[model samples]
Target: MEKYDNIDELTGLYNLNGILSHLQGHETRAAEGSIVIIYLNVMNFKSFNQRYGFVGGNEFLRGLAGEIKGLFPEELIARTAGDQFIILANSLDEKEITDRLTMLSEASARHDKGLRLHIKAGIYQQTGDETDPVIMVDRAKIACDDIIRVYDKSINFYDEALSKKNELRQYVIDNFESAFKNRYFKVYYQKEVRALTGKVCGYEALARWQDPVIGIISPLVFIEVLEDVHLIHKLDLCIIDMVCKDLRDDINSGYAVEPVSVNLSQLDFELCDIMAEIDKCRDRYDIPVELLHIEVTESALTTGADFLDQQIKKFRQAGYEIWMDDFGSGYSSLNNLKTFDIDVLKIDMDFLRTFDTNKKTPVILAMIVNMAKELGIHTLAEGVETKEQYEFLRRIGCEKLQGYLFGKPTPVDDFNRAVDCSFDVCEDFSLASYYDRIGEVNFLGNTPLRDKSFEIFNNLPLAIIELQDDIAQCIYANRAYLDYLSSLGFASLSEANSIYGTTNHPDIVEFTACLKRAQVSPDHRAYADIVTNGNTVNHKIRFLFDSGNRQAFAVVSRNTSIHEESDTAESLRVAMAHVFNQYFRVDFFDEDGTVDNIFLNADQKSVSDYTRDAKEAVRLYSEMYIYPEDKERFKKFYDITTVRDRIENTKSAYVVDYYRSATPGDNGRMQMYMILPFYYNGKWKFISLCRYADEIRDDDLK
Candidate 1:
């Protein structure tokens, strides 16, 4: 029974039971020699197992056991727990213990050349009155934790207070389920408000417990206890059920209740079919799925990408919106956004909390909000405790905000009152007051059509301006245009209105001349270099005279400041081929194998020849011009079907392929065709770069 129960089969080390038995036997027998039990722990053992395989981890443990046996003869050694070992060291002082630990560290370093193993030991001196071996071991483990944190220390003596703390923790774990069943565990809600309108949009459900023994216990304490006991999922499920019941009650009461977001732990999924449990709760209460939101922490997503993605898909499929909570609180914030299809990104409060201390915090917050907007995801700033933080978030266009300033987590009754009041107040504020404050719609005489038009274009990703050509004073500028000007250090449209032709600025003078010409011919298009905020940028301008309105409008299109050279080259080539149809024919091959050809009037016979029948030309190039040896490769590489499939599968904008093309020209020249394949308007098009045989490098294939 001792052998089966006490010995670890893999490493031949005595188990936790054996360690206890040895300590108890020594106490019963009154063994002499001042015995001290030292609990040893391998630091970051989980990381070790991840770096080396489980088999290797077991071997390493066995090897370390052997070395320990050699270091202390006739000592009782036991594997207490994961990466934890217990040793009964007799007749040894602190110095002797320290020396032994030093030797063990050196031996471990020598054993594994790639890895340096760190070991920490906690010592408990046994006295005659000490009866419970479990308590003694617990105290030693507590000391080991202290040593683990302080890297300079190799060994530490057990403290009485740590033992008491451990007893409290153990008590909480033992009574968790009973307390939860007795209604001590409860759900509290904190309202999430829209930053711009200050309207309560939803609530985040937070767990709280009023323990009988411990009185009101913070979730910060009980949550760790539950997690340690592998019972956090139980708490999460209970909270979800409570939220659903509350939502159903509110709906029955004829109150418009916002959706409540429930936090989930990574272990929740590992513990059970959480989705099934959530569905059961929803079905039982007959609650709409939209009323319950699922929030998973960003840190939880790091370990299991594929599994979490599947879980998220299931949640979304079941009509539940998923919010990535505590975003940027851990590593890979941007990566989490890319990997998960989250509906809302909740920025970590740490960003807002450090706003005053860190100069770059607000900039980072703004950038994150901008990035989320760019990805078509709404952003929620968490922990907005101050009016300054709220106003800053609002100015930066953060869609949602939640913090102490709005309200603390409260009971359902109080939360309902606050929600009702917020929505009522929001209703009193019209859309015009909230969104139409921009100059564009205000300058357009407030007509419904003009306001609707402004609304449509205001939120566009590009900067747009509706300019009156006569005065050239800025009449209307979209949100994008205002944001662009702000980024260039201009405060508003009025401050950045130097682009008007009325200004004596060189850029404006050139732009005015182009507008006048366009007004006369209706086809004159031009570009001007404008200096704003110490930086020069080229703006392409187009003018059109609306005959019915008797007003000429100038459209100023700003080019992106940061564009890749390859993109620029591609854009220029496409534009040149499009505008000068006489120089080179632009052929767009549809995914269905149909081709649209734009003819260029050029002296080259091949240009005219290909433009006459683009489809036949493409077929001949695939059949005849392709080198016989490279025919199969060329066919696969240049096939529009293959390009379309590649783009679809990879979600990539473009793909490039290079192959030998035997042009049907003088000398039957062997030229290299560098094909740039792109998908546009639901079709695939390849722009070929004609390289002469002399210019074809040997490394072109690579």
Candidate 2:
């Protein structure tokens, strides 16, 4: 009866009491040398049991115990607790112990029905100083718990460092209640600004621990400890309450108040009615529900996904906005976006951490923004600390922005003081309306002339200008439009604006008439021919928006000469070829290395015999016209197969190569060849251009 009572019924292994009794007889041997105590726990055992039945779980444990006994036949083993096992070894052979542990882990995995059974081991080497087996087991347990949340490590050794860490963790857990009641956790607000205009649109609330005895405790330290103890929900709720009170006070003080967002932990929903607590705080403070946004991390949705989905629905139905925080930080980010109806995606700052060094970061960021826009969800880029990052996000149509560039997280009072002093806070701004207007314009069109540089509109080929009010004040112009202004004898857009304000230029009058027509038109689009510097230019005007005192129109300009009734298709083709030849000598080729056509200015005489094969023709031309030093480069540039592969691999619209000409009247001037690939009808075609390098702006090449 005593033997049966000392053994575990499920695995027929020694129980805790049996192990302690055996250890008492080995104390004299332990005092002679060092002994090792290994504590092992099955990770996620509860979830495993939930998946497999209790009978199945018991069977798995029995199999694992059998494997452990087979591997450590000479050592004493015990089934101390549920999903936990203890081993007492007389010798401290680290390699031998690790080898057996590895075999046990592998055997358990091989028999894991369908779910992988992960086992974590903690080893404590005793120098014969302590006689208490319970204390040794406890120390081993501490080492195991230390790595409970770590994924890469499976085994840890007990040491004084781990002991100290456990002590600190216990201290935090013991004083959590006191910290909450005494208001040691303070709320900090980080401003979120409109990307288009640097105006404060909203703020995110963060919690900071101000310990009375230890000065300011970093959230990184306390937050992790609280999360491990499942007390993070308490701190999160306290933060929500503090944010609500602060907003109410701000309203009472007649300060401009924007929506403040609060973060919630996953445990909050499981431990308490988080939604109800939030609603209670809102009602208690008499604050509007719309003024409070809820942010949940993407990783939080991985566990209890269905419950979180329902909870998110409840919050949305209650008129609270839901933002998925730390997007792209987890593996299931896209799945979570599809499962939950998220309003905004707070992009992870890790993407921008290597923004300068990593080339893929900007491309990934742009794709995320575009994908969110297509799904009708907004985007907010966090950790924007530079002007370059700000401009990039703005150009990519990111709706909201946050980071140290605008301001760091601060206390409510300090934030208010900064706002009163110099912070640019937007009052009564409607972010929805702003994004709605921005969404109407398709900045990246599928047209052939559209530039691939999505980071800046200045690289676009068409002249884009923004006009305001009835008098047609030029408010903004892209680089193309600025160049167009310079063509009309104005050094800059400001010079042209000065002329429009002082005198009635015929072009201004015609543009103003076009703007009025666009405003009244059903589709808000109109076209007009404006005369400037003895040349007629066609302007297509579209009404953008009207803000009581001012109205804006987007004006796209093109030369009207080609649109004349007298110009036939053949004449237009010839005229266009001639215009293109003025800047670049052109060649058209098919994918099969066939030169279909060529266009050159009168000054550029053909120097090689015409050939049907495009690749051979390039080689022949390079020999005849390329400088001796640049012949190899010129030939390589025209390698049709290489160019085709490059375009396809990079998805680039065009590729450019630079070289010099060796022709008799040429002075070895730097020349650029640009190759553009296109799919026409049923086959691929390439358009190649030869131009003097100095004539083109660097921005145009982008």
Candidate 3:
């Protein structure tokens, strides 16, 4: 009935039926010519189809068929599946077949821009014993699959080893659902230790599959196989759900549970809504967002794919911490860091191992640590297997560490046991020394300052100034110092000091000279008498210099005659200082909905605009940083009436709420704003702390 009954409608090629019927005649004359069956595949055809639509994919196939026909017109050809082409060539050697295939690839690329094909092939040379076309085709397909599995290989011949691997892969695919139903999959975790303290801060989740029939399968092998079969998303989602359930169980059982990071492939986002999937598991198990972390590799971000950008934003907005794993293994590793809102930079252990052999490796590692610090991003060194690598990274200011040195990834029971007894870093390891190496001049807890001096600095009756530069500038000062300046009708410490005339004041002059001398000597101090507020008081000015941070500090302690301010002003000062030191930006709005003051902690490496002008600050907050969809909501929340009502109705001393906005780095990542309305200076003033959404928690806010 049909003229070419076995012809493929799309490619005009002989279908499998026609090819097999044609092959029946060739089998009788096998001895007359050498027969080689070649199976060609369009690698990543699904990705191409996704990148371009179905129509585009079909067009590419049609163009590819034309090129294949031009190269092998006399050979028997067939369209097997969507992206596979089979060819039976006679009287041609292996070299001739290779040459023709290479030519066909180039011609296809030249014909149409969209027709460039990444071809992988498998070959089977027919023997005199072979008679069935189905057997030969199956062997060729197995050979093709071997080349595809390697990915780097272009072609492979059918062999026993490749056939075995194919059989294993088929077994996995056929029994995947059964294995899952029988609870064969498992989630393992490796502890991530704090480098300075050696405390187990968190764990990284890894997958394990135990097949009853096959005993155990390596994750690397099975993960690749799952990806090939488009079942990786199912596995990834399963792992997420398992991790969440485990976290909930651990908490219920009173096991000290830490956050666990999970690896997600690019395909996970492509297959379904990643955010929705996460929400499904989170809601099902009632898991807190902070208990889970998302890890994407450096290579994944290097693809410059739009899907990653969209998915990352949604994850961040939903308060999920994002870690960039394998930091230095990609071509665009450093560039990806600049573009992504990656909270932790997990340096690959390969970089550390190379330090012993490569002269420039340590320098590069140091540079990465410094760059990450300057960008306000924390660094985590992964795969640390030796004491030397751990010390080296600690010295270079890596915040977190994880590897074989701590302990390998283990099952839930083993991980809990290992972490139960707590561990400490080596006895000789000093956190202060590590801090010195990183040039951290400011200490928050348990500082080495004299006890009396520390108390006076916080609860002093006078202004305490900490100068960080050679010039008469203040980097930090206590609440008493700020209040004193405000009492003098000065808006800022800088303005008040300028009016005091530091050049003529002997104490100020000596303080500047002491800082310069401390650049070379550690123990440097200068004392002098100066008149302030109509009183001549003795002042003790000490120069503290940190060579590592390349910073010089002048700690000036003088007797303050005034100890108290208006209750509201004092409360405002304390809140402002705490918010400023912790967050990148803090804004204080008056009861009239006007920005009264703004404090910005700008990273030198990043672009920033921190204008003190109230009107301009309001415009920047409302128009520039706030996303279009959130602007109206943000405005409504911060309105004068809304603020007054919230503070009154809220039982807590401060009314706390959250809103989203933009930051200088990673435009897609919205900054979480903790808006608190407090009674300050006899009116309702809202103080908002601007931080990355991942770092905030609803429970903590409440």
Candidate 4:
């Protein structure tokens, strides 16, 4: 059973500091001297999401999380965004694992149906040699990297290269949001050229962020984080928007602008309605869509080929070409040719690394180039830096080449000036004039609640949950639902396995199934305490269901014990007035209700004054501040919900006039923007309030 004292209500991620009484229990469990790290990531979460929607994507994740919990008890689990899920288990067997996995896999396949969940599981045994549990998990993760990317039987052990990448990736995650606004992130472009002529054709946009303190940011590091914060698509949009604006202006200034290709993240594919957004850009910039090109990772194409196909069709309709990027990066690259329509296939630079005139290069390169030609697809060689590499590619009949041979990525402004009227329109040209060496570069750069948290007791709705027997599955939760897990130890949720932390604290079995059932039902609301029992927690819980899979649960924890009701009339007025301003508009009136002041939910005092008008119209309209249709509704609501004295004011506005409103939603919900008619001086006038609910408890106000 999960029990804790404090439930943090801020961000959804769990914290350390959990069940203190079980501290010794954790030590003993660690002393069992056996630990297993299972780095299990959901394969193709981004693809699934792109095909479905975010809600469905999350439903898949939540459901999978539940199934995983059922498979392992006394294991720590934390969702590392996208499809990655980590598990740290204490004292388990090899045979038991296989049996458990087979059982779970069959069950999941049955339950998930069309929303298939093919998981990549990486395992490592902790021999107590590793000081940090995270390191043990890293070892397991190294084992799973290829499996995650491509399901294979050969599990790799941790190596220097993988570990280095892991450290870089983990660091980016730890500082994701903060890194975006930091100085590190910047653009890096690789040149794309016409192969036969060996001149620069275009540049494939890239990202490189270098930090003074943190070195470089790797794409592996920040990409997952970007997806979590919903910023990847925004970043892509920002880049595309900037490029379109800059490129259009340059083209008109007599610059021969070759189409540039931009790499799109999976997050971009999912969040953005690319077709509509692209059309908007085309119209806005009045530029031919063919002037732009987009490259999708071959892996990305392999998983969500249909979506890419539709996008490709859309772009072509809008007159743009599509390229399959990093063609040799994975085995799926070749398959993508069969599955997806493409205008170009950019050869990976790795092939060049093995190039020697007489060696393995000529036959393979010649064969690939011939294949592209036979298929009627253009072949572009990527990373042709040296004269020898460029010359060799040209002889092979490749149509395009991109590398340091022509010019590296330059600033948009620099490229515009550098490429202007400089080379033959038909010949492959170089941006060599603008290419310059940059210093060292650095790295480039989801879920809800669960059960096990409901064991603790709390007040109001937050405590309103009943576990599904000892399975500890949360069948319900109230408004403060999710906040009950914050500040709870994350060891359970994370790899620490402290027995008190959230990452692993309470394993809720089949959690996704319950949520799916609830989501489709009208009575989907429920409550549970998401913290431990040892401490005095004032948190609430919230339950949300994943719409797509409908099986996953997004348990949100909230702190709702701070509402303070004041006795003083002014204090009460501020509190009530704030609720109105925050959610709607509120007004106040005097005892006799004889021309008491009026409250207007806005500033710009130069406009009509509510106090003056409210008093004059009070007798005829007690519903003076409220809309006529809402007047009776508000009256009844006030009668039942309000506990204060004598029909206080009973007026409010976001009103431009007696019959009209200022802004559509200006009726109440904004403290400073609210207009409160008070009995000030001899007349009634609406006083603007810019107060919030929590600020009402402040003694400084009195």
Report the number of clashing residue pairs per model. 4, 0, 3, 93
Model 4, global lDDT: 0.52
lDDT of 3 by residue, 1-702 (tens): 343777899999977776776677644422236777899988767867877888888888898898888899878788988999999888777888889877876776763456345788889887767767688888998888766645357777887676677778878888889978988999888878777666667889999988887888778667878887788889999999999998888667654566789998877777888779888999999988877889997767856456687788788898888888888773468778667787778888778777688989978888887666655567788778888888887777677789999888888766444345333322222242353244331122222133322232443423334444444566567775575456545698778667444455655565455445444433354333233555333344555655553454555443323333322244445564546344656556666535533343332110112554444555556675667777777766655556556766875555544556443355656666656766655776667666776766667555
lDDT of 1 by residue, 1-702 (tens): 755897888778888877777766743433356878888998756767888888778878888888888887667788877688988867788888888877887787655536766889888876646667676676777778655535467778866665665666777788887987797878888878877678776789999887777778777667766777899999999999899998888667655567789999989999999999999999999987877889998878977889989999999988888999989874568888889999888998989889999999988987887566556567789999999999898877787789999878888756445446445733332342243133122221213224232133443223333445444555666775566667666687877665453466665555555445445442444333344444434454455545554445555433234222222334444533423212222344444555433221111223213443444556566664566777777666656656657766776655555555553342454554444575454645565444455655566534
Positional deviation of residue 554's Cα in model 1 after best superposition, in angstroms: 32
Residue ranges of candidate 3 with Cα displaced over 4 Å: 1-21, 24-34, 43-84, 90-117, 126-132, 145-151, 196-199, 228-234, 249-256, 270-277, 283-286, 297-304, 326-340, 345-382, 391-398, 416-702
Q: What are the models' TM-scores?
A: 0.52, 0.60, 0.51, 0.44
Better of 2 and 3 by TM-score: 2
Scored against the true structure, residue 167 in model 2 reaches a CA lDDT of 74
Q: What's the ranking of the predictions by lDDT, best on top?
A: 2, 3, 1, 4
- Model 4: per-residue lDDT, tens digit, 1-702? 233231112212111222111222443333235766666666656767777887777666666667777776566555654666665566676666656666666656643547666666677776657765556655887767645555444234455666676677667766655656663566655566655444445667666656667776666556655665677776566566656776687578665566667777766767879657766776788767666787777767765667777777876666677888778775566777887778778888778777764487767877777666545567777767688787767666666777766776665535445543345532322342232111001001001122123233333333323322222234455433333344333322222222322333332322323333334444453222122433222221233534342233434433222223211244334434434323222334333332222222222121112443433443223343345554544333323123132335443232211222222344543222233344445644333333333334455243
Worst 10 residues of 2 by lDDT: 563-572
Off by over 4 Å in 4: 1-31, 34-147, 150-184, 210-216, 227-230, 357-360, 413-421, 424-702
lDDT of 2 by residue, 1-702 (tens): 877877998999989877777666643323224668899999767777888879889988999999999998878899999899998887768888888888899999865786887899999888566767678878888888777766668889988777777776777888889998898999888988887767777889988888888767777667888887888888888898888898888677666678899988888888899999889999999999889999998878877889999999999999999999999874478888889999889999989898999999999998898767656677899999999999998888787899999888998767545454233566353455665456433343322143233344443225334455455667777776676666667887778878776677666776777677677766686655455776446566778887776778887664434333322223334434433433446666678777633344313333322566787778777876678888887778778778878876878877887888675566887888888776656877677777888887877666
Which candidate, 1 or 3, has the higher lDDT? 3
Candidate 1, residue 395: lDDT: 79
What lDDT, from 0 to 1, does candidate 2 have? 0.75
